[model samples]
Every structure is written in C-alpha cells, then in structure tokens.
Target: MRTRVLAASATGALALTALAVPAAQADGGSGDIRITKVVVDGDNKVTIGTGSAKTFSVSVTATDDSGIAGADSFTLAGPGYGFESTGKPSCKKVSATTSTCTASVKTDPRTDYLSNAMAGTWYVGVWIDANDHDYVWKDKAGSFKFQRGSALTTNASPEPVKKGKTLTVTGKLSRANWETLKYGAYSGQSVQLQYLKKGAKSYTTLKTVKSNTSGNLSTTVKATADGYYRYVFAGNSTSGAITSVSDFVDVK
Candidate 1:
C-alpha cells in the first residue's frame, strides 16, 4: 500500500512537470532567471495611418531565484521611433528585489508593428541601473523585437495627392524595363507600396498591396487626416543601389 501511494505521488509530479515544460519554453527561461510576464498595451503593434499619432504602453515583469533587483529603464530602438515624453526614462521599482518599468510613447500611425509591416524589425528593450548612473547594466537587462512595418512596392508620378478627396494611383512597368544585375538583380520580383498625403508634415503608409510581375500596381489614397506624404516602394536590388527608383510617388 505504501509503495502504491508513493507511485501515485510520483505520477502526479511527473504530470505537473510535463504541463510546465511547454510553458517554460514559450516564456523563455535561462537557468534560474525567468521572464514571468510582458504586457504591451495597444490595439495594434504598429500604428501608422492618416490621422493623429498613436500611443503604446509596455509593462514588464521578471523573476529569478533572487527575483528582480530593480529594472533600470526601457528603450524603443529601431527605425522610425518617436516618443512624446520629455527627458530621460524613469525606472519603476516594484519590490526590494523585483522591479518593473513602462514605455508610453507616440508612434507613427501609418506603420504596423509586424515582422513584415515595414522596413525591418525594431528592438524594444528594458534595462536596470544597478549603479544608478552606469550605462551598462548586465544584471538587469531584457529585450524584445517588434517589426517596424511591411515591404512596400509603389509607383507614383509627380502628381500631388489631394486632401479630403480620394487619390487613385496606377503603376506599370516600362516596356522591357525589367533588368538584373548583382544580387540576382531583376525587376520581376514581388513588390509592396506605402504612401503619405501631400502638405502634411509627416508621412504615413496608405496601403500595402502587391504588384504583378509586369510591374503594374495601384491603390486608392485617402487621408482621414492631413499631411505631406512621400510614397516609397520596396524593389531595390540587393546587389547595389539603382540610380532611378521605379517606385516613388511624391504626394504634394
């Protein structure tokens, strides 16, 4: 009877361990240090549109054998990142051994925070200042990546996009215009589009659609808000930069 009870307890322990393994992998654990929670408050990861700027919030929690000594600070590092807050970041101390921090900043509205949302992925990290003014905090540091936006392949002439009204753009390849050079250079590759309205100070991605191998693409543009926008397409050859961009629509 004692043997059977011991066996039952062992089975229960195994079951609990099995249940925790997957979670541990997903959460990312290094030895004894573990990240318990990371909460980013926002409807969309990357918010770039035709209106006001977007705001985002980040909440972090970490746990180790000794718990967190105190979070240093947080940073939004990558292309096209902006903050409305003034001065330096303020670290929030949660407990004697643990700490938490947040990032409340306004971001561009036309972009999405996805792997393919924009040009490249952005790194958002949290750091703790153990010595108060020390630049490098090895003991308290954590980071995550957020894709800035999607690849854009657009085509526009010198025409200016009108505000309050819809602007229609049509894209087509020059006859026999596809050519290849260094990095498997060619014009038959897939393309994407991003644009901003004219007269506005900032640029926003209007739409992200595909283009045919023939280099024909089009999308309707409307500004729920007003701004000067320069349209750019993603079709540059990996080998080298081209003298002329086939996918540029200056909206003004």
Candidate 2:
C-alpha cells in the first residue's frame, strides 16, 4: 500500500511538470523583437574633454517578425553614468523585418544632463518598444573611456649660447581639472625631453624628468648644435597625451 501511494505521488509530480514547460516556452517564443547591432561614435571607445560639448552618434539595428514600422520606438542611452534621456528617438524602416535608427546625444559635463558623469569605462544601452512589448539591451554598443585634456609648454633660455655653455630649459605640465574647469598642475609624472637638430626632421629623446610639485620642469644641458627643444608628456590613463611647441635655440 505504501509503494502504491509513492507511485501516485510521482505521477502527480510529472503532471505538474508537464504543465510548466509549455508556459516557459510560450514566454520565450512570444517575442520577435531583437537588437541586432549597436555602434557608438563609429567605434567601441571614445574620449571627450570636460566642459566641452561633443556630439556622439549612435547607430542601432533591430529586427521583428511583425514588421518594423512607425509603431516601434528605439533609444540609445550612454555612459552608464547615471544620466537619463529626455528626448525621443527617430527611427526608420529599412526592410520588411529590419529597421535602423540613428540618434545623437551631446556630452556636456557642465550641464545638468552630464554634470555627475565621471571619467572611466562607460557603456551604451539600447531599448526597443514594439507591439506592446519592451526589450532592453545594455552595453550592446560597447564601452568607451572619457579622459582629461593635457597641455605642455617649454622654453629654452639664452636663445643663442656658446657651444661650451650650459642651456637651461623650463616647462610645465598640466591637465584639465573637471571640478575647477581649468588646467591644473599634473605633478610627479615623467616627461620626455626631445631635441631636433636644425637639419634633422625627427626629434630624438634626450632625457626623462619628473614634474615637480608645481608641475614645473627645469633642466640644463651643454649646448651642442643649433636645434629645437621640446617637452612631451606621454600622459596617463586619465589624461590625454600632449607635446609642447618646439623652442629653437642657436648655438654659436
């Protein structure tokens, strides 16, 4: 009698399992909306300077068995940096089941829309609403890095120096500070000093020096030949590379 009761319980469990499979399949097969591809600014990575407005182009492709038309809407949200979209997207049908949407968003760090956006790896999110169904995809357009802008300046004193005399060079390295909206000293970073002889088309590295607490650089070298001296900052992950204008010094 106990074995029969156990068999009955097993049979009831099978019946309930049979009913659950069809419901799961229905939910999985009901939707035809899918995001095929997403591209941001024609590349997977992008960089923009703070306080500067940069237009980012987003390209999205979607497909639906019901035929894409005016009833469907699409949007591309970016940076994954806690910003929301306040505008509608524009889309156009390309074929019976495929549609392509093009949209643009301006990244302005000074505005409310992106005031809290921080520099780092950020992603783009795509959403599609069609036939009373909503489908969302994040990071489909890949990721990008936003970095600070940097600048470098150099000056070689005593424009004309005797061949045996010492030539003094001074410069500064700075990078954009988002909080201050101005360029500030980027201290304790290594920068390369390069020299190009009068007839040489390429500049060769002379030495490397670290910026002081104030981002100031000063170095002296014996005058050799008439050449142009410049400082080059290779930049860090958070800043963009910069090269100072060449300062020409004549050696007599």
Q: 84-151 in candidate 1: lDDT tens per residue?
A: 12123444556653455565655533232211222223334554333233222222233333322222
Give the Cα error of residue 228 in candidate 1, in Å: 35
Clashes of each: 27, 0
> Model 1: what TM-score?
0.32
Off by over 4 Å in 1: 1-39, 42-44, 79-100, 108-118, 129-252
Task: Compute the lDDT of residue 219 as modeled in candidate 1.
Answer: 67
Model 1: residue 244 alpha-carbon error in angstroms? 34
For residue 226, what is the lDDT in candidate 1? 35
lDDT of 1: 0.37
lDDT (C-alpha) at residue 216 in model 1: 58
lDDT of 2 at 84: 30
The models' CA-based lDDT, in order, is 0.37, 0.64
Candidate 2 residue-wise lDDT, 78-133, digit = tens: 33233233145677888877777777666554542232234555444555555435
